[model samples]
Every structure is written in C-alpha cells, then in structure tokens.
Target: MNHTPVEGFSKLSKQEKIDWLLQEYLENNQDFKKVLEQYYNEDADLQKLHDEFSENTISNFYMPYGIAPNFLIDGKLLALPMAVEESSVVAAASKSAKFWLNKGGFKTTIINTEKLGHTHFILNVEPHKVLHFFNFKLKKKLLEATEAITKNMRNRGGGILNIKLIDKTADLENYFQLKASFGTADSMGANFINSCLEQFGKTLKEEVSKEESFTEEEKNSLQIVMNILSNFTPNCIVRAEVSCKIEDLKDDSGISNEDFAWKFKQAVTIAEIEPYRATTHNKGVMNGVDAVVIATGNDFRATEACAHAYAAKSGKYKSLTHCTTDNEIFRFWIDLPISVGVVGGLTNLHPLVKFSLSLLGKPSAQELMSILAVSGLAQNFAALRSLITTGIQKGHMKMHLLNILNQLGATEDEKKYFVNYFKDKTVSHHEVIDEFNKMRNL
Candidate 1:
C-alpha cells in the first residue's frame, strides 16, 4: 500500500477532493463517500458558505445542538443554546439552572471588558533610552497612525484605551513589547486589535528611523518580531454567583441542607488546592461554556485557552470556582476571564448562530460574557452537587445508557424498557449489556 503526496489539492472541486480521498485512502468506498455527503447542507448556497469557512473543505462535521431552558441570569429568564455532543452537559446545566431559580437565580457582574494586543520587537538599546523614546515620541505617533483603522470602533464607544511600553530584557535578550489595550463594544475585535498592532509596528519602525535622539545602530537594531492579539485576556473578567440560605439548599439525596452545603464547600475546596481534581473540575465547567460559545458563533478554542490560563494565574492550577458559607448563607461563584463577541465572525453568517443570538434577545458582548460565566458556574454547581450527594456516575451513566443501548442495536421498545429498568437500578455498561442479552434470549 504505497501512498504518494498529491499536488494542487485545494484547486480541486469538492466532489473531486472527495474522490481523491476515497481512491487514495479509503479504497474507493462509495459507502464512506455517501456518509460524507449525507451531512452536507441540502441548500447549495449554505453548503458553499460552510465550505468557505476554512481551507481544503471536504464535508461538514455535525454535533448535537441542544437547549438548556430556564436560566435566570441577572433578573432575566433565558434559555441557552448549546452545541455539544456529550450526553449529560445540557441536562446538568438545566438541572443547576432550575435548582437555583427560586433562590434568586444567578447574579453576574462585568468586572472588566478590556482586550489586549502586543507588538513585540527586539531592541538592543538601554531600557531608559527606549522608554524615553516611547514616552516622548513613538506613543503619540502609534495612536495617530491607527486612527483610520479605529475610527469606526471609536464611534461605537470602543477603541484603543492605552498603549504601554514593556521592557522584557531580563527574560530574553533584547526583548521589548508594546502592549495595547482595547474596548471592542459588541464584537470580539481580534481583527481590529491586530490591525492596530500591525500599524503600531510599522509606526514604531518609521519613528525610530527618523528620530535624531537615537543612534543609527540603535535604530537598525530594533526588529519587529510580531504583532498579534493574545488569547490570554486576564483583564476581560466576569463573575457569576449563586447563593441561598443554608436551610434552603435541600435535595433528593436525603442529605440535610446544612450537611449538603458543608460537603459541597469541601468538594470545591479540594479542587481549589488539588491540581488533578481542578483539571477535571474545570473541564466540566467548559463543557457548558464551550457549548454556548459554539452555538453563538464565538471562538471556543480561544475561550478555553483563556480560561485554563486564568485557572493557573495564582501560581498553581486551581479551580475557577470558589465556595463560601457566611453566617448560614451558602454561596458558590466563578470568576472567568473569557472574551466572546455576539457580532461579527460567524454570528451573521451561520443560520443556526443567528437563531441562537436572536434567542438570547441579541445581547451585547458584555452581556454574553456574563451569560458564559453563569453557564460555567451552573455546570460546576450541578457537578459538585452530584459528587457530594448520590455520586457523579449515577446520573451521568443514566444519561449514557442510551448510547450503550444504541451500540448493542437495541430497538425503541427495548430502549424504553431499559430506561424504566434503570430508573431505580444502577447503570453500567456490562450490567446493561447483560440485562439486554437476557431480555433478548427470554
């Protein structure tokens, strides 16, 4: 089986690409080709739009889009759109939302909404000389150079907030940074920030070349390394929290409200201290966050990177969520540094994404940030509640039972029977398979 690289793959048509893949790798399996085409949008325009979203398009990969209803955030009742394939994420989020609804629901605060970009360069000059040049000459020129790029943003009350010169020579030889902060209004503003940074880079080089205060050697020594927006937005912060009287925190697990509150706090405390537990703990939180982010046409990868980095911002990997019981009032909260936009990107392009945004009443970027933070907090609360009470697997495995039955090729009637059978009994793969086999045999 010899496989050789092909040329001009991107030049090929969609059908041609699929044919080449089939002949080269899949042994020309028509069945597999059919599987690929099955997921394509029936409308040609929509399919073409999806294809242009990335390079080397072949087929659209699908995921389950679900809704978790009854979310009360900051005195508003909203249902979140979640695009995830995992079995229990939507269920868990919905359960948590209902549990907290009567207890004043989730309260969120937009702590900050400043996004950052950097123009990194290497300059073998004295720190004071560089700082003097930046302060006296280059900073104003940088802002002036980006006026064209930022006029629209400024009109919307969002634009370049400030730019600072950072000296990083100790960390690396001849390393310096021009850190710029921005407010992007309702958009994520990656392109806007990057455009401004690149212009700043150009202006810095131009200013250095013309300045009489700098020696020719110093001017030539300055090399622009890169200009880009950072995904690690620590300053773009949102806090989501839920609290209730300890006596009101009752559940079907038979644990007393006080006992439940104490145990829940203890579980969160362990996650705060233990890296291993914190990793899984945060993953559960993202399960909810990413789902909504994707459904709303935001960048989930950037959101995840920012969140994980924030969890470790305190010099150790710890939980994003925190718990406290003050004078018999039990409280759980999460402070997330997530930057998401409700406009631009796929928000207007994708049909489902448009529907998702409309479903949320067309929130601003700040409101979306609060929504994401609350979703994550709700997910964490549900997971912690289960862990402290009946255990994580009982409910999770029950949700997972359908997948197992489907794997064993169970019919709808069998699925219904097993669903009822496992209503009281514990669910496991082997046990379900065993019971399924016995039922079929009988």
Candidate 2:
C-alpha cells in the first residue's frame, strides 16, 4: 500500500504530510475484520488457553485503558490505543509524535516473524538416564501431546509448526529442558500451549499402568520447572521505521533541523550508555508496545520482561532502538520479540478488552504485529522530539496540570483554566500554587 511518504522528506510541507496521513487512515480503517464475541466451540487446544477458570480477582479488573491520540502506524493513523494509567505517557507520546508530524510525519514498516518456545523441567534423580527416558519412548507421546494442540491452529491455517528440546547449561549441575512448538494462530498461544503441556505432563507422571511396578521414588523424582507461559518468545519479531525531513521543522519555535537532529541524537546517546536513562528510553518503547498488547488480552508482564531483557542482552543496558539520518531524511528503527495474538486470549473476554479488540477489527498476528512495530517507532519519535525541542517538561507539565489542579481543589472550569495557563508558562509547584491563589481570589 502506498502511503503519503513521511511528508517533509523530499519537499512536502508538514501540513501536507499530516493531511495525506489522516486521509489515508480514514480510508482504510473500516475494511478490516473485527471479532467482538467469544464464540466457544470444541477444539483440541483453545478451551484451555483463554481459561478464566475460577474467578481470580487480579485479572477480573485489569480492564483496557487508552493512550489517547497523536500516533500513526503501518498504513493507518491512530490516537494510539493504550491500556495504562501513568499520567504523562499517553500525552507525551501524542505530543512528541505530533511534533514530528509537523516535520513531515513518521514513516514506518513492520517485518514478519519466526518463533521458538521451551518447556524446561529440572529433575535431579539418582539415576542418570531419567532425562534420557524420553528420547526413546516419549517420541510418540510428545507427538500425541503436540498433535492435541493442532486442531485450533490448523483451522486458522497454522499448527504444530515445529518442535525441539533444549538443554540449558548442563554445567549448572541439575538443569534440563523440554521444549515444543505450536503455531500460535493469530493469538499469543500461551494458554493454548500451556494447557497442552499441563495435561500431557499429568499423563507423563502417571504410571503407564498399575500392572507395571513403578516405584513412588520414581514418581516423586519429577519436578516441574514451569508449566506456565514463556518469556523467551522468538516466534514473533517486529521491526519498525519512522522518518522526517528537515523542512518539516520550518514552523518550530527557533530550532534548526540539524540542531534538533543533534539534540535527539544526544538524548538517545544517554539512553545507550546509561542504565538509568536506558530504562526510561526502553520504557518509552514499551509505552507504545505494551498498550496494544494489553488491549488484545495478551500478557503485558511477559512482553515487558522480554523487551528490557532483549535491550540489556549485551550486558550493558542500551537502547532497544536507534535513530539515523541521511542528509535531509531522519529515520528510526527497532526490533524486538512482541509475542501477541487475537485468538484464544482475553481478547475474547472482559467487556472492554473484547470491545477494544473489535475496535481494531480482526487483524492477522503478523498484521497486528506490524501495527505494534509502528506504534513503537511513533512513541520513540515522540520521546526524542520532546527532548530535542522544548524539552520534556513542556508537554509533561501540561498533562501534570490536572494532578496539581485537583490537589488545589479547583472547580472544573478552574482546572481547565489552570491547564491552559500551565501550558503557557515555565513550571514550578510554587507557580501552580500562586496561580491557584490568584484564581481563587478572583
């Protein structure tokens, strides 16, 4: 699909860029497939993956939230859907990306993905061949366990795509691993696969029969490492890109494109070398990625853990993404495992989550992944532009005005006045109090 081409790149004006993007998204946003109800039917796997089981208080109330607007992704413009409550984040992302839009808008793309998953069980036994027992006899059982998961995935044109076993550091003395692969369909598949593993594990631990004299010691030797979801998701990899042109900044207060570019680079540089800064930088990345993940009912914790873990994999925590420029065109890129899906998940549960998923319509896993990649890029652009331009405090302070206004016991109109007033001034708490007193006296 041809897009408006990140406006200011060649010779387009910032308004020209935003106009083209808004027009393009309005045209395409309606045709997508969207599912709003959880239609449960018998399948080999799905019944367990989205298991609400008995009511658990924790998940019962973590409803979907919003990130507000001002970001666009893949071939669409979005206010950027988010399910978080950290006050400044959504506004910060909106403010930053809006700033970039005036410089020609963000350009982004998402690449396809491949996957691998592991199920490790640590069993320390007197005999050495306990781990070896499965190699010869469990082949059929492994296939049976895996095959049980294929029906749902296959219906959607994917299934037990592959399977393998991994050995964690054997030198660690008591560690071992068992891993399996099941094509996740258009969902994260954590529940689907975990249920299969749990049921099969019960079968594995149970005696083949009472006819065979299997000792209690043998049964007790088994130890479950984790029969839950995995953070080492490689099946999905998302890559995104965003760029703007020097001419896009013509309307900025007084900064040059080259200066803003340098400033943005310096801010990213801090994130690269400093862990303290990197966490925030990476948080900005997740600020975009996690919102969409939660809206679809996928696990946000796993995505968060894996994302930062990936950024710090080099031992020195650094940026999960990098920004670049070629003469007049500035660009941003990020690659990370964002395991997510729309089927067999909470995407079908909870009133609002299901509603949010429907609002997005039905998107293929890869297609949805592409959308996420673009959000990440737009979010990163938002953060960098703020740092380089008027600085972080400008937009942050505007969103923060509400918190302070509430504290001052301002009426609704008074709060609105304060927010506009706060947007127009340099910030300090005393300044807020002073403004409050002036308004109250009036």
TM-score of every prediction relative to native: 0.99, 0.74
- Each candidate: how many clashes? 0, 11
Error of 1 at 230 (Å): 0.7
Best by lDDT: 1
Q: Judged by TM-score, which candidate is best? A: 1
Model 2 over residues 1-442: C-alpha lDDT tens digits?
5655453433544334334544675563322211111233245244344434433111122333765565545445555567765566666666656765544455544443444455556555433354455565554566675565667667876665554445554555445556665666677777676776675565455422221333565556556666555676654677766666755545365888688777777787788899999998888888877877777667779888878777877788888888666787766678877777776656666555676666665677776777676667667777777777778777667667777778878899887777677666866677898878876784
Task: State the displacement of the C-alpha of residue 263, model 2, in Å, after optimal TM-score superposition.
Answer: 2.1
- C-alpha lDDT of all candidate models, in order: 0.95, 0.64
Off by over 4 Å in 2: 1-72, 96-116, 123-140, 169-171, 199-224, 246-251
Task: Name the weakest run of 10 consecutive residues (lDDT summed) in model 1.
Answer: 211-220
lDDT tens per residue, model 1, 88-121: 9999999999999999999999999999999999
